[model samples]
Each structure stands twice: as C-alpha cells, then as structure tokens.
Target: MVEKVDLLIKNGYVVTMDKEGRLFKNGAVAVSGNRIVAVDKTSSIEQKYSAERVIDATGKIVMPGIVVSHCHTHGQASMGMPAEVEMENFYDELAKWWWPFLEDQLKKEDVYALAKYAITEIAKNGVTTVDDVMEAPKDLPGVLDAEGKAFLEVGMRGILAFEATERISKENGKLGIQENVNFIKKWNDKPDALLRGVMCVHTVFSCSPEMLKEVKELADKYNAWINLHVEESMYEVEYSKKHFGKLPFEHLRDIGFLGPNVLAAQCVNTSDKEIKILKEYDVKVSHNIQTNMVIGVGLAPVPKMIDEGITVSLGNDGFYLDMFETIRTVYITHKGVLKDQSVLPPKKVLEMATIDGARAVGLENDIGSLEVGKKADIIVVDLNEPVPLNNSNIYGNIVSFGMGKNVKYTIIDGKIVVENQKVLTVDEEKVRKEAYDATVRIWTRNGFL
Candidate 1:
C-alpha cells in the first residue's frame, strides 16, 4: 500500500531540524511531487516507493533550505556605492545614499536585471526563500515596477513590500501606502504564486502614526504582512525616548503597531524591557549579525531574546547573498559577544536559518522543515570537501565550516532551481553582466563611483 515517489534522494545524512531535532544517518527522502512524503532509512525507502528521479546524495548532508528573513536583493546592483561622505548622522545615511539612489539613479531595466541576478545568486547559495523589503520611489517609478516584475520572472518564493514613508510629507506617506495597496490587490488571489504581498512602513522614525495605522489596516484587509525596520541603531532608541518618553518598542506598543503580522528587523539596540514587549506582541526579529558588526552597531541580544520567547531569525542585511556565511556569522558573533561558547549552539543556529526563519515570515507550516505535507524546499551539501564527515559532530561542522561552494543542488516546491551550482531558470552570465554594467552606470550618474 505504498505510494510511488516522484523523486527520491538516497544515501545521505539527513538533519531534520524539526521541533524535535531529529537526525537520520544513511537516510532517504521520498518526495511525492512538491511534498516530502517519507523520510526513513535508505533501505526502507527503496523498498517502499519507486522514484522517477533519484539523487545519489552519498557522503552528503540533506537539510531544509535556508530562508533569508530580510534582504534587499533589489540593491544587488548598488553593491559598491560609496558610503556617504557627509553621513555623520543615521538619518543622513538614508537621505544621502539609500533614498537618493532609489529616487534618482535606478532605472527599470536595472531593477529587472538586478532582481534576476540576485535570485540566481541566492539560490546557488542554497537559499530558497527571501523577504525582499524593497523601497520604491515616492512616486511609482518605472524601476520600482520592474523590481516586482523581475521577482516574478525569476520565480523565487518571496514577500515584496513597498517601503512606505511619511518623511517627505503627510501626502507622500498616503501615496506610499496606496502604492502598497495597489500592488497587494494585483496579486492577492493568484494561486500557486511564488510571491506574496507586504506593506513596509520604512521604520517607526520615518512614518507617522496615522500612516502606520493605515498600513496596518491595508495589510489586514488583504491578509498580508507588514515588514519594517525597528531599533536598528543607538539613535533610534534615543529618538523614541526623546519624542515619546519611552524606548522604541514601548512607543510601538502604545500605538498598537506591534503584532504577529509585523516583522521588525534589527533589534540591535533593544533593551530587556523591549524584548519583553516583543515577546508579548509576538513580534518577530530578523537578526542581521554581520551587518550590525560591519556598520559598527552593537550586537543584538539574540540569546536573551530567544530565551524570552521571542522568535529570532537570521537575515543577511544586504551584506552578502550567501546564507551560509550569515549562519556562520551568527553562530560565531553571538558566542564571542556573550563570552560563552555555549551561548548559541550550532543546532539552534541551524534552526534560525531554516525553521525559525520560516516562522518569522509566517510560512512555517508550508516550507520550513523537511516534513510530510510540507513543500520540498531542500538543499544538498557535499560533505566530502573541507567539511569533515565525522558523525561525532556533523552538526557543528555544518554551521562552522560549511560554505556556499559546497551546495550542489537547491530545490524549491519540488522544482530544481539550481543543480551542480548552476541556476536553471535564467541565463546566469547574462544577469551577472547586466548587474555589473548597471552598477557602473548608476554610480556614474550619481557621481558616487
């Protein structure tokens, strides 16, 4: 009475970072179309289900593919732009570099090209899902439209949010919110869509209370999520304290903006009280450990937050496309900062990259762990390389020494997006050339090269 498997991956060491954290040696996973129907010993699976296609993952580790909790992949072509010379203050970094780049220099062709390139890049690194928090122009720019189009073209599963702001004026905030509403309406009912809609209020500092409520209402009406940056730096905490007589999270709690649907990125400056508030509101945190270290911001209290029942997930924070590097950074940085090797165990960090990240994006039941009735978003890593295959500490090797180069395959929703380190959905070379050329042009146009 056994059903046939559409695909079977045999002879791999499977690390199912499920709630129970199970591991199976010499295991096989039988996939019935998009869902993993069975995970058992290799001998048992071979006896039960016949496979149309078989992947010999011998001497490899099979696990859930990574989900990047927050990424601005639309900025792939803006990689090398100079840090603003006059950006002494936090707000100035936005005005001089990020906002101007979005408003003045980017073209539609560039957004399309950049998105195409970013999708392939992340997939090659074994990342199957990403939350692209795109900051579109104040007016609906051609490039912003193309960014969405490119995401659709690349066939990457994601949630797209138009970064909304009231910084220019109250009218501009309403316009930004409307843009989000329009995009959400366009794709709300599409079945089998890899993309979902989100309303991104840029940050608490940039949006007015009315605009925040409007965004919340729009997201609720569409049953979509709201993504935003919160407590990213020291000044953000001070600004909230000065303006509202409370910390940043306290301000959000008072205004009723903290909710399960709200994804708050980068709580690097959050206090213990703020962590408690986050746990109460069920707010998810996208911990960008590398970006914080690079930007000289203090480390996030991730272990404390995790202990407080706040769901902390890993994010790249626009630093690199490789999720492996991000995972390594989180594991090492938290341990170093806390002065305890036992702070963030490898198993916990692995969960952050997989299941916890899916929970942050509210897709836990659909595609996090490799379980029955869940979408087969899986990656195959070659363990015969520098990654030692010793069974004594295979889990530690994966988090510490595993690199993106070791990833041999990436599958999303039962479809092979990357095989043998090559992207199947698009021309990799063409996209890379376009991204590089566009970066040069955008930089020259802005006089920042």
Candidate 2:
C-alpha cells in the first residue's frame, strides 16, 4: 500500500542535522500536511509514499531551514540610518539616542510593515524560524498583534515578545509587560501554534529585580520561554558591579531567574564564572557575533561557553538579516579571536544555527532537524559553486560557499512559502516599499531625518 503525502522533495544531498548527523547523497523527504512523513534514500521514499507536489532537488542540498534565535524586526527599516560617525559610542548610539528616539517613535503600523519586510528577507535567506523581541513601548497594549501579522504574512514560525523594562517609567514598563501577556494569551495559549509568544526584559539595568521576577512568574504561569539581553554591553557589566555587587549572570542566579527556559541573548562581557553559572542553569545563549564586534563590545567567550557545556546559538541581530553571513562569521570569528582554527568548526557553527538555535528557543523537538514526526521546515540550496560537494566536504563546502540567494526553495510547515527564489506568501516588493515608507514616517516624526 502506498502512503500519500502532500509534498515530495527528492534527488538531493540531504543534511538531516540530526543528532547522528546523517547525510545522504541521494535523499528524499516526504511531507504530509505539516509534518515530515519520511526522510531516507530517494528510492525508499518514492516506493513507500506518493506525493501531490514534487520538487526535484537535483544538484542541490536539502536541509533544515535556518533558525534565528534573536532579532528586533522593528529595526529592519532603520538599517543604515543615523550616520555612524556622529555617535560617540555604542551607549550613546543605542541607549541615549537610538532606543529613546527610534523605538519610541515606532507606531503600530511601523511594526507590521518593518517586521514583514525583515521576515520576508530572512525567509528568502532560508530562515524558517525566529525569536524576535519587539521594543516599542509607545505602541503598547496591542502592538504585538502588529508584528504577529507580519509573521503571518511572511508565513514564518516565530516566538514574539515585547521587551518589558522600566528605563522610561514603571508605568511604561507595566504596559510593556501587559503587551507580552496579551500576546501570549491570544497566540500561545493553544497547542501547536505556528506563531507563539514569550516574555522578555530589555536588560539587567533596564528592569528592576522585582520586574525581572515578575516577568519570570508570567513565563512560568504560561509555561512559556523567557528571553533577554544579558551583559550585552560593558555598561551592563559595570552596572552589575556598581549596583548589585556581583556579575549580571550571578545576580540572575541569586535571584532564581536563570533557568532552562531563559534564553540569554548576548553575554559579550561575561567571565568564566558567569559561563559556569549559565551552564549550571542550562540557560541557552544567542550569539550575535557581527553586532558585538561592530558595536565595539568585547567578543563573547563563545569558545569558552561551548567548552563549559553551555549551548550557544547564532542570531543575526537584525544587522545583515542574513543567516549565511552569520554562520560563516561564527565559523571564522572565534578562530580569529582565539587564534585557533580547530575551535568552532563548520559543523559546530552550522549546528549553532540550526538544532542548537531551536533548543535556545525551546523548539528543538519540533522544527530543528529533518526527521520523521517533525515539522517540515526545510530549504533547498543550489550548489552553483565550482567546488565539488561530496560526503567528506559537504559541511565545509556549504558553510564556506552557501549563499541564501541561491536557495531555490524554502518550505515552511509543509507549505511552499518561497519557491524558485520568489516568495509566495506575500508580495515581496510591496512589503519592501511599505517598510521604506514606515521608516520614513518614524524618522520624520522623531525629527531624525
């Protein structure tokens, strides 16, 4: 008896990204509805199941789609804004100006338009999932719905949150948290939802100890994930020492805020002790290498974190919004920083982008790998490079040569969201235009233009 499925993708080099690290030179994946039904040799899948839609992936690499563990989609439209030379430093650029000027000026429609544009480009870049923190206190209450609409329009899986903090005022902080509460109740209360909600705080200094514990309680009540920036800047570390008399991670541990469900975004200034603390709590780290370096923040001890049994995952941080660039950077940056070529190999960095990323976002069991009974979030990479892609060098070659522009197909939840480099879920150009106009509105209103 033949088992029928919704989609069949065959005749490609399949990288399963499984724990066993299975790769097949001539592999196939069968999807029914939203789950993977079969992943094996092409002949085996072809014999056991027939599919309604077939995608021939000859001369391509079939693999799980990229997962971005952290990003601010609202920053999409602000790319290349506020000429960099004018700012004194990162603190002046972000805390004194950017957050105060940009984040507060964001309207509900700006969140929708910019998030749509960012997610669309990320999907085209073979990213199937994201954990996004939208920081718009002024557009609170129902602002999360705006970004949720963008995720829906792009047809990407995501964990959305509003960054709750008291940097402005305690009441604004309350509004920020209420947005996350509303979003979680509306979107994540149900089972097997494509779009979900999580709890977030801006940073250690931005939120008080009471606010942090309160956020944790809400996450626990909903059984949801908690995410936040952890020592992302030197300012945060200095603040911790001056105010709390301990490191930031240590303060979290002392306060019972470090847990498996907590996804720490950037530990750029963490020490060995802090890394051990994170390992003790099984807290996941989302590493945005490019932003850390570009902003003059010290490079994170990523190699040390990995060595200490902490899971470090890749996130673009809305900077190029390209995971291929992030994977390549993660693969090379640590080696350059530590001057050791053996650390953070291509396979490990790729895992940081895929399976480890899913784990960081608490979705490892569902969508990280290409396995039976898992969600069908996959991409077909076109091997147009001159180098030969074989079993021995497949991982190396993909990490070194794979470009998101060459991804021929991007399938999410067994649906063809992007096929042949053309997005099907929404009009790509229209959303791009919408994002441009929205940014203009924000800047003009804030008088930054």
Candidate 3:
C-alpha cells in the first residue's frame, strides 16, 4: 500500500547532515504530521508516498534548517546602541552600555515586541531553532512569559532562559532565578510546545558561587538545560581568580555546575587546561564568531576543541540573525587565524551549524538532520544563480556564496513558517514598527536619544 504523507519536497539537491554526511541529487523529503517520514530520490519518494502538499524544489538546495545555539532575545530592538557607547573593550561595553540599558530602560513590552521581531527575522533566514537568553531584570515578573508569547506568535522553536546574575543586586538575581524557574515549569512539558524554557546563570563573574550552586540544583531538580557564558573575556577569568582563587571554568567545575546539559557560550579565553576540563565534563560550547570579533576579544581555539572531541556549535550571539553569514565567517575566520586553508572545511562548518547545534541543545535525534522520524525542520535554498550547485561543489557554494536571503522556504515541524522569503506566522511590518517604536522609547528613557 502507498503511504500518505502531509508534505513532499521534491527535485532538489538534498544535503542530509546525517551521521554519514549523505547528499542526494534529485532528492525529496516526505513528511507526516510534524515528523519526516522519508528522504530519498525524487522518483522513489514519488512512487511510494502521495503527499497532501508538494513543493517542487527545482534548482534549489534542500537541507536541514539552521540551528542557532546562543543569542539574546532582548537585544533585537537595542542592537545598535552598543556601537554608540564608545567602548574601548569588552568590559567597557558591558559595564558602560549593556548592563545599564538592561537594568534601567528595558520594559516588558519591549521584550515581547523585540522577541517577535527577532524571531520573524530568524525564521525568514531559515533558522528553525534558537537558544535565547533573555535579560531585563527590572521587568522580571512576566518578562520570560512575554518573550514566550512572542515565540509562540512567531511560530519558531526556541529554548528560552532568563539570565540570572548578581551584577545588579542579590534580590535582582533572585528575581532572575524566579523568572527562569517559573518559565521552565510553565512550558517545559507542554504538549506540542515549540518554545521551551531552560536555566541560565549569566556568567561566572556576575554569579556568586552560592548562586551557581543553587542554579545547578534548580536545573537538576527540573532536569532542565543550562546555558551561560564561560570565560568570554580576560576580565572574567581575572575576576574569578581574584574572588574565588580559581579560573571561571575551574570554579564552575569545582562547584559541580559543569555537565553534559550545560551549554557554555564563548570560550574565547579558555586555556588548554580549561579546555580539557570542558572535555572532561562533557560540556558543550557555543562559538559566536562575529560577536567575539566585534567586541575585540581573542579568537576561540575551535579547531583544537573539535580535535579534542568537544562539541562546538555555531551561534550568532544576537550580532546578526543570518546563520549563512555566521557559517561563512566560521569557515574563513579560522583559516585566516591559523593561516591554513585546510582547517574547518565547509562540511564540518555546516555540521556545526546543524547537527552539532542540535546536539548542543540535547535535541539531536529530533531536529538536526533530514532523516526519518526527525522533526520536519528543513529549508529550501534557491540556487538559480549562474553557478551550478552539484554534489562535488555543494558545500563550497553554500558556505562561500549562500546568503540568508537565498532561502525560499523554511519548514518547521512540517509546517511552512516562511515561504518565498516571507514569514507566515506574524505580520512582519507590524512587528518591525513595534520594534522600532519600542527601541525609540527605550533609547529615550535610557538617555541615548
């Protein structure tokens, strides 16, 4: 008997970022409900299954939807203000601009509006999943819920968290914890939930040891995922050593906080020993290439980490929503830094953006690849340019020439969230206008205007 499926995407070059790295020309993917049922040659899929809806992907590149491991949902509206701060270094930017804006000016509506706006852009850019850290302690009671509402309205998958920190005050930190724990309890087990909550302790410098231990206990109690920054700057390491008499990762490990469920962002300043510790504990890493360079922090030893069998995933870190740009940046940045063109090949970089990212978020079996039984999170890239997109040159073309704008379709959970480069879940223009108005209000209140 012929099988019935919900959707069939046919006649494209499919890059299955699977365990064996399979790529099939004239390919097709069949979906049923929210799961992919089959991925094979177009002729085979056509003969075996009839779909309710079929997408003719002629002259396109069919691939798994991109995964973003780290970003701040709160920064979408207030992105450019950091450039206006006139900071000489990372510490200056954080202390003078970033913290003050979050503490004083951020509001509940701003969080909701900007999160919807950012998720709209992310969907259009073919990113199906995002690991987002939400701040704005002053508006903590319902801030994560506001962001969660935005995520639901935008129809994107997200692992959300409130960044718990002691930099502002212990009371504020307690509120942050409350926000995250409440959100996690509210959404972590909701059926068919596209947005789930995780635990976030902002960074080692901003979190006391007691706070870290409490966060860990909360995460363990709820069996939640943990996301945080680890040694993103020299100042963080210095602060940890001066205060705790150990490095940041060392202290985290000692406190029993580092684990397989923890996703550490920007190990830019990790020493060799620290990297070993990360490996020893099986903690994942999120590499934000553009943000690190923009902040003038040193480059992370990604290639070395990968060699050490540590899983390093790619993230834009709210610097940009375009994962294609991030993929290209990861491809070339390491080559330029190492002066070896052979380092970090296109396939490996693409893997970091897809499957490795899924692994980082503990969802590898669900959404990372174009395989049977995985979530139908996929994208169709328009490859109608003059250059031919074939098996031999597919990876190079995708890394070197692909842009987020080239994505013609973004399918999440077997549903078309973005078609023809436009988001289907929300009013794009309304979201943009609200984001701009919120930014103006925030900037004016923060004295930036």
Better structure of 2 and 3 per TM-score? 2
Top of the candidates by lDDT: 3
lDDT for 304 in candidate 3 is 90
TM-score of each: 0.94, 0.98, 0.97
- What are the root-mean-square deviations of the candidates from the true structure over C-alphas? 2.0, 1.3, 1.4
User: Between prediction 2 and prediction 3, which has the larger lDDT?
Assistant: 3
Candidate 2 lDDT, 103-217, residue by residue in tens: 9888899999988999899899899998998888877778889888889878999899898889889999999988888888898856567799999998888899999999988
**For candidate 1, which ten residues in a row score worst on lDDT?**
136-145
Evaluate residue 191 in candidate 3 and report its C-alpha lDDT on the 0 to 100 scale. Answer: 49
lDDT of 3: 0.89
Q: In candidate 2, which residue pairs get closer than 3 Å at backbone N, Cα or C atoms, i.e. clash?
A: none
For candidate 3, write residues 1-449 as lDDT tens digits: 78998999999899999998888889999999999999999999999999879999989999999999999866765567733667776778788878887545788899888888888998899899999988888877998888888988888898998898998899999999999999889988874678788899889878888999999999999999899998888989899899989999899999999999999999999999988998999999999989898778889999999989999998887769888999999999999989999999998999999999999998898888999989999999985689867778899889888898999999998899999998988889999999899888888887777
Q: What are the clash counts of all predictions, listed in order?
A: 0, 0, 0
Give a tens-digit lDDT track for model 1, residues 1-449. 66677889889998887877777789888888788898888898888888778999999999999999998766775666675568776667677877787544656676667777887888899998888766555435333457667766655777777677877778767776777777777776774567777788887778877777788777888888888998788888888788878888898888878789888999988999888899999999999988777767778999999999888998886558888899998989878877899988888888899999999998898888988788888899985655446556877899988888889989888887888998888888888898888788777777766
Off by over 4 Å in 3: 82-88
Can you tell me which runs of candidate 2 are displaced by over 4 Å?
A: 83-89
